[model samples]
Structure formats: C-alpha cells, structure tokens
Target: MSSIKYLSAILILVGLSTCGAKNLQEQNTLQQTAVQLTDKTTPVVNKNTATPKEEEEEAIALPPKAPLPSKKDSTTAETFNHSRWDRILQKHVSNSGEVNYDALRNDPSELNIYIDALTHNTPTDAWTKEAILAYWINAYNALTIDLILKNYPVKSIKGIKNPWDQKLWQFGDTWQDLNTIEHKILRPMKEPRIHFAIVCASISCPKLQNKAFTASTLEIQLTQATKEFLNDPTKNELTKDAVQLSRIFKWFKKDFEITGSLIQFLNQYTDFEISESAKANYKDYNWNLNN
Candidate 1:
C-alpha cells in the first residue's frame, strides 16, 4: 500500500508540471500575436521624410527683405535714391539711344533734383562696393549733362575747357572732377566693364542707356551692357579672325587685361570667338555729341 501511495504522489507532480509548461507555451504564442497586431495597426512615423505641401509652405514663409540695413547713422550711410535719375533718363533718352539734349538742357529742373539727391546721399562705410560704383557712374553722367547744358549747342565734349580736369561739381562736401572719379575711384575697382557703362556724351562712347544704374541691379546691368556693346556690329566690328574694337579698348587696354590678354576679354562678351592673335586696331572715335 505504501509503494502505491508514493507512485500516486509522483504521478500528480508530473501532471502539474506538464500543465504549467503547456500554459506557458500558449501565453507566449498569444503575446507574439498581440505584438504583431500592434505593429500592423499602429502608424509607423519616419521623421526624416516630409510631404510636398510642407516644402511649399517652408518656401513661402520667408520674410520681406529690407532694402537698406536698419542700422544707426553713425555706423551706416544714407541709401542713395537712384529713381530720380531713372525717371530723367526715361524721359529724355530715346529708345534708339538718341539723346534729346535740347529737351535735357531745357528741363534742367529734373537734372538738378537728381544732382541734389546724389550730393546728399554720398555713400559711406555702410555702402557696398556696388553702391560706390553706381554713385560715381550717375555722378559722371549727371555732371556731364550739367556741363553740356551749361554750354549748349556744342559739337563735341572736347570743346569744353579741360572738361575732365576742371573740378566743376560738388561730391558731398568734397569737390571732385570727372577725371578723378574715373581714374581714382572706378578704375581701381578693377572692372573694365565700366568702359561700357560710363557715357562721355559722344557718339563713339557707349550709348547713354535709357535706364539708370542702381545699386540693386548694378552687377547685371554692367554685365549686360558690356555684352551688348561688344556684340553690336557697328561698334565692335568682330569677325572670325579679326576684331576692330572701340577706341575705348585701346585707351583702357590695361583694364581689360584681367584674363592676361585683351582678346580673352573681348571673347568673354562676344558670341563669335576672336582669335588670340587676331589683328587688333581701334576705329576712329566719333566725338560729335551723341544727339
């Protein structure tokens, strides 16, 4: 009887162990199923990726840019107003680049207003190199107009008594002449394209553009005007192997040597390639006032 009772207790222990093992296995399977279901049902978010609408909103959310930096006057210069000159240029300079000098001379008030704006808005340390360039160009053209009106009915700009040398204009509180501005200021800027931008009130010179150069658009204006001047067949007379350039190139050859040769400079602005050893000469500069 004792042996039978001991066997019965052992059997009971074995059955309880089997039942616990089976329950653990079923619990593990249910846990795995729940995990898989959660993985499928829950949204998987990838922070790295964005929708297209988000990109458009980001692009459109930019703030308005200030024209001039809002800084103290002690640290900055006044912004130059080039609009007055633009208006005057549009009114007087024709679409074909012919200057109505008679009209320009008669309507001195607009020119005076532009000069006054220039005189007051002399750029300082706050100004950019572009601003300085635009200033001098407008100054040169305005003073040229003033000089022409002062002595109207003149055939050539050379007719004036040492026109370039005379300190005929007031630049801010200091006095400067056309020669000083061209040589001392703009030339040292090392941009030869100013040759095309600065008009000398002559037929041979670059045509007085109907628009004024502003600091905002100085770079594009300079580049475009240079290209136009070089590509103009009547002005440059370019060919496959020969180039008869304006007298301006001969006069300011050193300025165009940024690429080690004048041919390289001319090639930059011309569609037709000019040979490096192409026969180069200057045509006679017509000095008659650009009418």
Candidate 2:
C-alpha cells in the first residue's frame, strides 16, 4: 500500500505542472496578440506639415493661359457702359492716383454696382480690338480697386496674400485674377503700352486715370498714360544719353522691345529724346499703398 500511494502522488504532481505550463503558454500568446492589435490601431503623427494655403495651392490645377471664347453675341462699347466706373474714379480717386479707401469702403454701393455690371459683360472676338482692349483695361483696374476695398485698411497691396494670383472674380466662364488679366490677355495682345495703362495699387505704378478708358478714347488714353508715366520725374528721370526708367520698363522689357528698341519705345512717349546708346537703370519700386 505504501508503494502504490507514492506512485499516485508523483503522477498527481506531474499533471499539475503540465497544466501550469500550458496556462503560461496561453497567457503569452494572448499578450502577443494584444500588443499586435494595439500597434495596428495606433497612428503615428508627423511634426512637419503643409499649411492650409500651401495645400490649397497644391490642390488647384493651373487655369488656362487665356479665357475661353464667349458663346454669346459680342457687345459694343456703347452697350457696355463704363461710365459707372468713370464716376467712381472721379468721386474717390485723386488726380495723383491716391485712393480714398476709407471713404470707398464706407460707401461701396457704386463700386459694387459697377463690378456687377462688369461681370455681366465679357469680351469676344466679334468685338473691335479697341473695344476689347478698353474692356480688359477697365476690367483690370476695376477689379484691382475692388480687391483693395475688400481688404481695406491694409498698408500695401503686397501685404495681401496672393494679391495677384487669387481668382476672386469670374470673366466669361473663366475665373480671373490680376495676373491672368495682365499677363495672359493684355500682354499677349502685344500692346506694350498696356504696361502704363494697368495700374497696380502701388506708389511706383502708373497714375490711375480718374476717367474710364472708352473705345473711342482708348488710343488717346493709352498715349496719355504712357507719356505721363515716362515724363513724371518721380517715375522716370530722363536725359538725352541716360535714363533711369520705372521698374515697369525693366519688368516688361521684352514687351516694349517687340516692335523696336527700348529707346525707340521711350522716344515715342518721353518728353526728351533717348539715344540708342543710352544707359538704362530701374528705380526701386515702392510697394506702399497708393492711398
């Protein structure tokens, strides 16, 4: 009886050890599974990220170089009244091109009305070259003023984010910003005189005429603008053999050179003659608000 009892006790001890070992293995497996699950569910974060503006710019595809042709019947300068814009300019803009942003902002009814009217009118090929040119010129200036008023009290237009690139308004079916109107449409037209015609709300830019550019007066306006810009001693200091021209000349040198030499283009408008061998240097542009 003593030998049988000893063997039974040993077998019982072995069974308990085996059970404990199995339990330990199961516990380890479950722990490993939990760890895997935690890793799978948790997300790692990155410290460096793009800004909202940067992300938005990245997401936008480039617009077409020029606006698409309008399908509607083309309108003439008479049908499209720019007198409203002319009135606004007369009311608020000074002879020297300083704007009353505070006053305009307070009473924006006229500006809003003009912009609404402008949006309804878009140019087509059926329109005369002069009429189309006048339309775009007025469009650019009016839009620029609208943009400034929308973000008034700012020191300079440059202070506004993406001032030139923001497509805040639509022309025809296409959305247009300042850059598109100036570079894509106006520049491609190969009328270098437009450099002076379109005013950027900056001190160094050509003076904003206090009257609208109409098809009938388009030639006169463009000529007057260019002559006034070049002769304005503040903008351009001219001599027979040397010239300190506005940065406009430097920026759009190619545009001016299309038909002839830079001197030739300047001579057409400059009060004094500019020699072929005249040295050209650009003035430092003032980005201060033309207010």
Which candidate leads in lDDT? 2
Tens-place lDDT per residue, model 2, 1-291, is 999999999999999999999999999999999999998994443436767766566557556477654644435324467998999999999998888888899999998888877787887556777888888898899899889988888899999999999999976688889999998999999999888889999999998999999888888899999989988988999999899989888888999999889999889986677789999898999999898
Show the colliding residue pairs in model 1: none
The runs of at least 3 residues in candidate 1 whose Cα sits more than 4 Å from the true structure, single-residue gaps closed, are 1-78
Clashes of 1: 0
Q: What is the C-alpha RMSD of each candidate to the true structure, in Å?
A: 11.2, 19.8
Query: Clashes in model 2: which pairs?
Result: none
Candidate 1 is scored at a TM of 0.73
What C-alpha lDDT do the candidate models reach, one value each? 0.84, 0.87
lDDT of 1: 0.84
TM-score result, candidate 2: 0.73
TM-score versus the correct structure, for each prediction: 0.73, 0.73
The per-residue C-alpha lDDT of model 1 at residue 216 equals 82
